[model samples]
Target: MSATAAPPRAAGRPRRTSVVRTELRRGVGPWAGAAVAVTLLVTMYAKAPAWQGRWTDATDTLHIATALLAGPLTLAAGCWQGGRDRRRGTLELLRSVPRGRLRRTLLAVAPSALWPVAGQLLATTVCLLATWPYVGGGRPYLELVAADAVALASLGTLGHLVGLLVPWRLTAPLLAVAGYVGLAVGTYTESPARWLSPAVEHASPWEEPVWWFAPASAVWTGGLALAALLAYAARPARLRLLALLPLAAAVAAAVPVLRLPAEGPWRPDPETTRLVCDDGAPGVCVNALDRALLPDISQALAPLNERLRGLPGAPARWVGGANAPGAGEIGLPDHTMDAVRGRLRNPDLYLNSAVQWLFSDICDSGGVTEADAERLADVHLAVSEWLAPTPEDYGVPVGPGAQRHLDALRAGSPAAQRDYLARYLVADRCDPEEVPVP
Candidate 1:
């Protein structure tokens, strides 16, 4: 037996990675990826200050940029890629290959479906890194970024299928426009269905998304894309029934999303909402997210703190976040508007905010006559002005009467000013009649 029959050469499957690499090189994949990256970078760069020092703002901005700008671009690129075989008269040649139709379709779609996701991930990495040095608390939401990537891949796959079905030359551009309009309208809708769209806005940077939202969103978008691909590409008609599996998964995932509250997936983030206080007679406290800004905030409010020191009914603490002001505490105004790069953009404006909060308790104007209401309002204005003069360009309406009262209060000795503030602090603002006339 001249041979233990030389071991038969094993048949090997073509290397999937090699095929993908080839497709990426020859197809529009790199261009698509580059376009997405450039788009995201440009948009984020334009609004750098808005998201620079906050993790929530950074992630939310990236999500928005991906959905609004990169999503349509990916769809267009996928559509163009899908139509290439037919346009080049290679569809028949592709069909003649020994590979199964589904396998062939997947290989052809590799470039279109994967590139945009890669681009998004790349952009996300860059942004999170940029935000790392600036942010004070709370980690980036990596799951949300992953969910966005999945959504982009799904969009690309869907666009590819659409291109295969529609032979029109303008299909790619038209589809892109439609995708943009649909996503834009979804973002503005009051209906809960807007949550299904990946472009939903997140207004509150202090809130964290629920744990399950990112996974559910991934399933919803990914399932639909997979089901559509199987339905269109499966060779045997019976195998198309397998599409039901992912379609069902998509429907199941959609139910919870549709039932989500108007706030979408977010809840108060404890870490971000937790208070970090500075040592003072009347301690100054800000949320942990703004912990780095504590010294700045404490310094800004120093003058007001001195004026209220040891006065009855004066706030024992100045606190921020959702914490309710207690018997001897006053709620701090949202400092986000006044802060930039971990410091107050305008300390005067911030001081003005604290002064406004000091007088924010609702007064039962119902008991006060119109003329008295007007007078109390003027006195309130004067007190506010004396504490923190509204920046001249800040646009607050300051009447001459309030101006005169403010000047009088300012010209008084420190002891007299303290005595007046002590009485004013204890007066029941609700009873406008009891409010001290400044």
Candidate 2:
């Protein structure tokens, strides 16, 4: 029985799971994760109203928070962790271990690289869950979130390497501050290179990111980090040449990012931007992303719509988005400002917005004299105020003359008011001569 040939066992390989558990237990791993979670949750709590009911807003806010706050914290934490072996005077012992230098470095770097990402993912899950019920359409951008996690891990690894190379204790804090400043500056730059920074801001809530952008960003940041690790941790000097492969990959990934427009990676999202209309005479159409708010918006605009319904030249549709208003359509003001948790916070304020949208066309002041412009402005204000009275708390400036006109319009019989509105709707606002008096 060949003495029951013992199962061939690998010589000195440590169990990966045991090593990972030990790494996570010791060092800054657990603390870093807790700090990141606490910081993100607190920041998101303070700004909850801005993103509570909107998927795009929620994701964008999370991205910004990760890039600005969590990222720096991770870098500092990684730097602190990297210096641990040196601080404990275990560098010689680590060097003398049978494990390969690269393996040792990777094991040591694990806590720094993985903890921050885990924390961010946890925070992201909480935020997305909170936003789920309130949001009507459009899914959260998980790809972008994944890319942000990769960027955090890359920053952590780089900070770890810096910690190993730089002996000073102050390097962590200084690096964190520098990282924040660099990210903030990149956000404001006009150059396309700003896209390379993980902190790029997205201004349009209706837009989705380009399909390839997130993957490219992950590759760009991850490749650079891997390259650095290979160059530094490889045993023989000749093996360091292998770092060039990842370095080349990083450069290749950066090309498309560098070629991106100043607006970064976003493109118009047809699904989110598609119009979802109510069944009213002068239909109210909000973007699909805000479809849940349609009932509230329609109710808020009901009075104005009642007045405009069946009138000549009145808008056939009150449409929200970048779409140009056609012959029988008018652009709707952004309703997101008036909404809180998918409900209208102030209906009167929203009504005022609709009234303003009815007159948003800019007339060439160049053609009109100052006095005419002032008169036109007052008449416009009176008409607007009559259509939808400004909320008292808004502190809207109303001149005595405009107030008198508004009062008169309100005091008039329904027939008279309707007659005046009929003429006003057909008037070309750009021409002072064409505008009807209130």
| Reference-based lDDT, each prediction | 0.88, 0.90
- Give the root-mean-square deviation of each candidate in angstroms: 3.2, 2.7
Provide the lowest-lDDT 10-residue window in model 2: 320-329
- TM-score of each candidate structure, all chains considered together: 0.91, 0.92
> What would the per-residue lDDT of candidate 2 be over residues 1-438, giving only the tens digit for each residue?
477898766879667798878977779988998899889999999999889988999999999999999999999999999998898889999899788999999999999999999999999999999999999899899999999999999999999999998889999999999999998998788889989899988867789999999999999999999999999999888999999998999899999999987677888899988889899989988888998899999999999999999999888999886566777788888866778889999999989988998888777778689878877888889999888989999847899878877888999999999999999888897788988776
Residue 35 in candidate 1 has what lDDT? 89
Ten-residue segment with the worst summed lDDT in candidate 1? 1-10
lDDT of 1 at 205: 70
TM accuracy, model 1: 0.91
